[model samples]
Target: MAVPTVPRLGPQIGTRLMRRFSSCPRAYSYADTLPNLKIGAHTRVLFQGFTGRQATANVKESLEWGTKIVGGVKPGVEGEHLGLPIFPSVKVAQEKAKPDASAIYVPGNQTADAIEEAIEAEIPLVVAVAEHVPIHDILRIHSMLQTQSKTRLVGANCPGIISAIGKCRIGFQPLPCFAPGHVGIVAKSGTLSYETVASTTRAGLGQSLCISMGGDVLAGTNFVDALKVFEHDDDTQGIIIVGEIGGAAEMDAAEWIKDYRRRTTDPKPIMALIGGLEAPTGRVMGHAGAWTAPGEPDAQTKYRALEQAGVVMVNHPEKFGHGMRTLLARSLSKSGTSNTLFGNGLQKRGYHATRRTTLASIVGYQQKRSLYLKEAQALEILKLKSVPVAEGDIGSNGLICISIDRSALSPCIVASSDPESDPRLLRRIPFSYGQATVENHPMMADLADQLKIPSSSRDQLGSIVQALWEIFKEKEAFVLECQIGVSADGTFAAHGARFGFDDAAYRSSGRQEEIHRLRNTSEEVPEEVEAEKYGIVYVKLQGQGSIGTLVNGAGLAMNTVDALTFHGGHCANFLDTGGKATSETVKASFQIICSDPRVKAIFVNIFGGLTRCDMIAEGIILAFRDLHMQVPVVVRLRGTNEELGQQMIAESGLPLHAFDSFEDAAKKVISLAGPQ
Candidate 1:
């Protein structure tokens, strides 16, 4: 998630390579001489299964494009061929040619082996051009790459990576379509990648690095991984991400980009184009991994997600080049800079420099002044200042004390009066907890402005509180414990007082005790401990004895809740099993719902995507048999083996009711629950 900053631009290479190249004048001079060197310029590649006809043609084309294909690997062809040395294996090739990178043109069945050989040989980068590799084998190859941590894999069914600036081709991508420039392209489809590169080059906005991340069910490298690489490549100032429908990789990339922008002062601009806009559901479009399931992200969903994350969504693949050009042009124009490709455009856009504070400064300030005010003194000062005091008695410790009516309070405080309502008082109070310094003064203030004072005038109390806030604003003299909250019966309750914002003090005080009491007595569940513990999310509703609802996916869960609520039925809790639900997880979810004494009926609604519906039905049967629950259970299953799941539920011979329609299930569950 943490992206390393691109090396600073200087006479030498960017900061990333400065440590190694700074010591070598020849390297620096070579870089200085070229200036447009791509990210993989130093990469020396060895081909796996090099003696094959396909490998020979691709390697020859790559060599003709000025790529550094140092050597090749074949089981028996271990000598020199086509002016390049061939070895028995990657390890042997490595010792002889000392290749730092590798490309695989081996058959689908042998693709995993080739990749494994490259990884074992410690080749830093491996690109697999073979297609139709088994999912399990790809998984193993991905696991190996992860365990090694040093090697980066590009594809199983991909066009591979091309560095136009470096004149290097590691995959099967046609070299004639690319040109060296500042823009970088990361794509999921092979033909789409070519189209992107061709269009960008046509627009005279050539690319620095163009990577086709492969069209496998689980790509070894995802959009986020490629984005990180582009983020740190000095040669790439603008980027275009080409995504397809199926997985959450695009969404993940969008989230990562947002985080990256927040961490770095200046971030390179990024645009995206998601494919499969008109493609039908359940149909695999060319790529084996391009088929999307129900409730999973589609093209429009990805577009919205990326757009919300600040990535410009190009409507068409043809517009990719124009979109990037316009975006970069606007950025440069906003900064009042020329069309230079490799400068810090982010800094010019008013990105603040990183803030650094020493630990000594914090410790020294805390040590300078350490003062505590007794409760009596604190109350007396507030009383003298004409501050509105709630009807409460001063405790032995001088803290105000009042009895809390638990029945009058809600399960949770949804909204409270603004702590900083008075503009004069706001000037003295720290805006955030981080800004709270030891030097600030602690002052008594009304927690609720609605609290009435029979003895004091409102205007007089406000003036006094403002004056006190100003006096204590310069020093850490505020006692946060003097705060109050409104009871359910419309009475102001004063609790324990503590100096400053001390978490431990607040927790130990009567305020915390009241919260604990409410949680214990209230029908509402405090947190989703059980669901969260089992790696799922659950949200409890307000009323007790309501129908409990369980479903897969957030969208499905929300739809179920809305449908139940719309039909005059109350939901006891909302549980999302997510995409990878198991029988164990479903049993846990059922147990959680049944634990709520208020839940009279359990409504299980699942639309499986990656999760199988049969697994959910099995869990329901297990829960019913094990828990021996009295509550009526209503189940509705859809998508991915739903018919088998329905049959299993029917054969269970349990009192559980199964339905095909969500509406029927909701109404049936509500009717079974009866009056709540």
Candidate 2:
């Protein structure tokens, strides 16, 4: 494999290198992209959890916005509700309503079942609003739909979709904020999705479909899937994808667009809003699974990939729609959509077409129409400035070849001609190129080998060194070896800091082989480093702080957190005991909290959804027994199992204080912290 020498973007001095890459390379302007398409007004919809608070609230709002919500599916409660018939099964709902799309509001564990049921009922579009669904559930649902039903599963954990002009608001999107139009909005985050929609609408362009694909770890469908749908949908003029930090989904989508642009004469314009430039890795905000875990994917890499593929980059979301319109208008002119006259037979009909053409020719009118081409040329200029390019070479295998600069070199060694290099030091450590790019260009691989580097060079030397540093420090290979084949993050890149498990025999057996196995199995090894770092256990009720935490019986947890924050408090963490709390789990939960230094005081608030509050109380008591406590503990026990829990806590005689009302308990905790 040949590695072509590429100029590094940021400068490096001695052993220190400056990596100043931003989130993603490109941003989108929503204001520039929206168009008015002829969309239908009737889009029949059904809701699965119509009885739930969230479902009812969202449905009522959707109904007010002209959504024809024909029916709903609720177990047992099957009378007329929300002015729609309620059924027990999706089949029953589908039969009565003949709905085109459905929205779901089931719990995480049962979300897969609900979605599968909807798919079985032949619902073309389904949106799930359940969070923290198991990863296996998402995979199974997507895989089953792909093979068995061919159903379009929108989200396993998402806010849902909305078609502004069509009046087809199938998801939980707030309709009042949306207007009708041609911009297609796809986002990973719900709030960001709404922001993009509002921005586009405010910019005088309506939306075709605003799809929030859920900001979960394992998503249902990717950007390419949504793009293809938009490409086929006549109402959709362009797509504005709102992405967040994490995953290679964006870059993969960009790569797909590159291929799509190559084949299609009339290509759908794509703009992107990839968020998370300031996001810190390992610290997952919002969704639990949406964390950017180490080297998987980030915004900067995605931006670069998208820019390479010719996606128009903008800065503000408000400008995205307008930007798209400008691109489209230019595209229209390039395709000769403007009125033109020909021959003397037309008689110039009170207008001189020849004179117009003559004037255009005199000052280069055709150049005004070639925006995309001009942009591509500008990119070429930037590319040349970033890298020293060489021409193609002949190969026996019909492969193209390009080599790096090797003006002065000795046999079996490449040397850097630096003034500071000593006579002896100059004889060793040859200079090498670590990065190259080739679109099925054969010369790249040959050039890589000549440069004494690998063929999978994705960026210039700075990036390559970064990847290498990460691999060395992290003791993990900088490569993603899929089942189909092997692909490196890049050749000659620095590695990430190693987890403790990387030092194990499994990793040492062969980094590449271990990575392949890990990728294939989707299994994670135990890293003592993380365990050691976050070993202490701490437990608290949903109370004041950021990162609102929750478990089963989300209503109770939510209420508790709400009350806590209402009293000038915030829930720093949410820990749900689910149905029942075990002593071991209680201890483990406490340890998790103790591991977090941000937690000052602890609140154990529970309103037993299924199991009694007494069990949770007992678990907390036992946790204090086994784990030595250093922080003040406040407990709020109510509903099912409260007596038994209180009895156990009292019997423990560990001086643990208890409370009933969440507010009172939060006040006590606030007081314990001593003012503010």
Candidate 3:
């Protein structure tokens, strides 16, 4: 088999995003890396879900690769093997032959149960090949393995691993594509890993271990977790990570590598390739974990972040070995260690070498530096106009620095640090200082940071605070009232009004008519229609309860809420965020509550299908922020840039909750307002 020398850009974003939506964080398990690429050809193995077509194909291929297949299990297919000895259960298979590991080919829905059964049988390792498993199933298996453990889980949708020269294979790949060697391969896709392994083999290099972690929203292990095993294994000299998109998992791994490299004298040379350039925008991909919701990590962005963190990026997968060899050459030269190049003269090929940093990066840096320079200049202009001053520093450290002058108090000016700045802060302050918005300033350095003004240049002073103060002094028209907030049920409540952060005597004046109505009726009987129309009733439930209802799109919503509760989150009521949603219908749906007082937090998951997110966003903003709804709402919007929807909430200046991950949004809402 040809060993892959370079890393391939594989399918990534959609899975990661799907994982985010599913609310499953990829588990980082370091112990899964086997001792060496040397798996004895005689090691016994079994198939857990052996009756399925995919499993049957993999079983045939695995046996072809020289794995000692002893038995199989398929519930009712007991005692009848598809081609091998078939047992009724994993226990029966285990009794017949002491297998070291077991491979699973169950459907996604039944994967966790299959893995759990394998674990119970004391199998050392389990490889799952089911794709699109539910998050709850992944988590259940993960939790079981973690707290009350047995076998290590490989994947529910992965290609499995190959021990190369040892000639033992567990996944679904042609074994002729790999040969044992020193380079370690860890990837998110089965096909991608095969490509890398194939390239390395062709280049005459061998693999220590080639692991194709599944691309589900929740993989059994993450890159960093797997790296720990590679680092400890004596055979691994260099490691290549093939990442795609969705979350910051790669970045998180890169950050870990930075710390790991700094701490260890003999850190392995690491290379990375991130894929997902042409990922579809609004649909969940093949893997449930591959969902790339809006604003979550994407492939290109992850690549850039990894590169900045000092990981060498290979532009072409075919050139991965070259990059690794180059880094190895540097490391070897730096250590003054004499080594011989073996297998093939692939490293000696006179291919064009590319520099990591290019002209585009330099130009981008210069642009940012210039923008910051202009901001400081503009701040100088504002100080001449009359704004108050509080000076702080960047501290040579990155933390924000600023000080507030005691005398610079106005009833309209609320401190930016105050969480509940009056919403009216918009009215008092101009949207822009010429071209800048309220987004600039805690002094002026904040403006530069917001504007992404470059920090490194003698000609560029980072003194944004001083310039802003100077500009404020000169600009009398830059009046800004504190940003606003109210109770969930629409009772007017300002931070300064309640907390008295500053002397409360200086709070912005004028209560709204709605606020007055709510405040007055807070003690008396409230007008039911008006209260129901404007305010959301919040109730907390604290008891052992099971069963949750989710209603929305035909199939998606059913799976979503069911999967959520199945994974341990208690779902009380699922209200469709769309489907002829009028203010009156919204009110009616909310009031009809056999579940309300008991329903934890309402998860309003809407993907804008036929319905525009802006309309929903607007409705939500009005119901909660302006009208003072009492319950915390968890909202997920897809199907549209939905930025317009986002912008509408931003303009209202209300603390409307929004998130790209349905899981993250659900978690946040549940934590804050779920049943007690």
Candidate 4:
């Protein structure tokens, strides 16, 4: 039965939307998922794929940690797996168990199907753990969700949620790392969520609820969705938002926080930690959605936004506990003393109020409307998203991305270029939807004075910004990098423009052939091209390195590289078999790593949530047996079927040494590599 939906909060988000990106944003709302996240002892939970190896393992752990596992769904399986009734479908299980929540532990490809089953059954809340879920599936699932608000999905690639006080743990987060307390946590990175919980728990603050929203590019439940729930919960007095780089979720959260502070009474303090600040722009991070895309805000942008929102910002994960604790106390102190500057409630930040938008924040706007692309959904994923490009993204980018040159003082328009790298630069100036046409404003003269652009190039900068903004607002674009040259002498050349349009928009565009004709495949990496054919992502590093990593999830892969680098080791390549990997694919990936002649050592780190551990172990063994391996392989396995995986490695007698901890395994690989 569909339950009554809570009206999504923060219509005030429109204030910011109007100022920046779009005139036509639908009432920006998502299901209030925090209520679902508020799992208590009485909240009966049902597991889909209950009898599967991964699900079974996680269910046991959840049960052991005090989760209310009333029943599960497993078609063709009779009886129960863990003293809980195992029905054939979510509907049957729902009827029997009367479950309020359902967790799907199916593989990545099947995650959407399982979620649909739960949704169709009217399951109020669904938590999915597959990391390799297709982006298209999430887009479809989200579309289905917007129609009505019966079902709320958490992760197709997350650890799930846990209520420290409720004693209801849905995901695979470390139990010891969490404790019942006053802080509510929401994050996209499962690994970081664990660290946040541990830090907060150690600080003696405990937690109200911890939500791993999954690091997929498009999350079913977002930062605002979770924050709205926490803002009202009595159990949650403060919030620790663990955000990752990439996309505008954090920035959006900052906006919502600013609006929420303006409206709410004595709002709880929020402390945030954004991960992968140093991650390469083009390379995908361990968390699937953690990397900075071409036009998305970087970690610093998000940090500044959150800081300006009165959120206590912590640069590292370990500071989560201390930071929130201090912020909460400080907030309390202010609340009691109204005479304090800015009163008791969180003060409005000058970030938005300041006329000078000095620093550059890579914000994206579209040429054509499709799904609400916040900060323009990553231009990289649009091809697979099926959102067609009305007009492609192209620009001439210099070595540095400068946010604003002196003329940035204007609220209506902003232009940027590196002062040191090149005085000549190209900029996208914002033009409003109504009344304020490009011709309406002669801001180019002001910008020219600020940028010291010679008289000859004033028209050049003015025309380009106007043209780009008009194109962006009218047709819509996903990503673009353009260059507007301005020399010391004021001469100008608009060269080096590259653009990519939303593929989902392309189907209706009837311009697919024309766009394809403008293709620039020459810049494509050959090894990456080959890996795509094999259904994997392979990005070889620039320099010859000794270690190669074969990991399951994007976040895990990036972290593995971080750990290796921290241990004075360099990774030869980033080879991800994706969320669901067969023995064939795993063996193939292993071969790819071994083929890298620079690889003196290989590290196999598999955190099997839905993906099985034994299968990965089998692939590693088979690869070594098939070809006498020249390098030592350090293996670390956890999660589903990990015990069997470890036993397999023990029996195989290959040079693969298995460890239970990431630190130990990383150290082993680094040591085995013996020097640079």
Task: Identify the leading candidate in terms of TM-score.
Answer: 4
The sequence of per-residue lDDT tens digits that candidate 4 reaches over residues 1-676 is 1111221222222333223323323443334334666678888998888888878888888888888898787776668667778798777887777898988887776777787677667788888877756444554455445444567878767888888898897776767567889999998877556656767876899999878778766677778878988987899988988776666688889999999988977888877766544344444554545544334555556767887787765544455676666767877787531212222122223212322221122322221112222222333233232322222323222311212111111112434454223212334342222313453255556556555667765665555555544444333333343445543443453433344343333333333344444434444666666666667767777676888888775545654665466556788877767666677777777777776788888888776655567887888788788877877888987666778998899889888899865667777899888788
lDDT of 2 by residue, 487-554 (tens): 24212222111211121113213333443332211122122122223321112333235322323222
Between the candidate structures 1 and 3, which one is better when assessed by lDDT? 1
- Write the residue-wise lDDT of candidate 3 on 1-676 in tens digits: 1211111211221232223222322342224334322345656778887777767777777777677888778786666665678888887778887787788877666776788677667677788876545443453344345432346677777777667655677776556556778788888754445446655765666688777666655566567657777887777777888776454567678788878877988677777666543332323222334434212344556666666566666533445665566667777677521212222312111111232332112111121100112223333333443322222221121111111111111111222332222211211111111122222333244433432334442112223233332333222211111112223443221111110011000111221222222222343323222323432221122243322232233123433343354234565533332232445544444443223456545555554433466886776666554345555555555433456766665566554466655456656656655454
User: Least accurate stretch of 10 residues (summed lDDT) in model 3?
Assistant: 496-505
lDDT against the true structure, per candidate, is 0.58, 0.49, 0.48, 0.62
Looking at model 1, residue 489 earns an lDDT score of 51
RMSD (CA, angstroms), candidate 1: 20.2
The TM-score measured for candidate 2 stands at 0.47
Compared with the true structure, the alpha-carbon lDDT of candidate 1 equals: 0.58
* Candidates sorted on TM-score, descending: 4, 2, 3, 1
Better of 3 and 4 by lDDT: 4
Off by over 4 Å in 2: 1-40, 293-295, 335-676
Which candidate do you rate higher for TM-score, 2 or 3?
A: 2
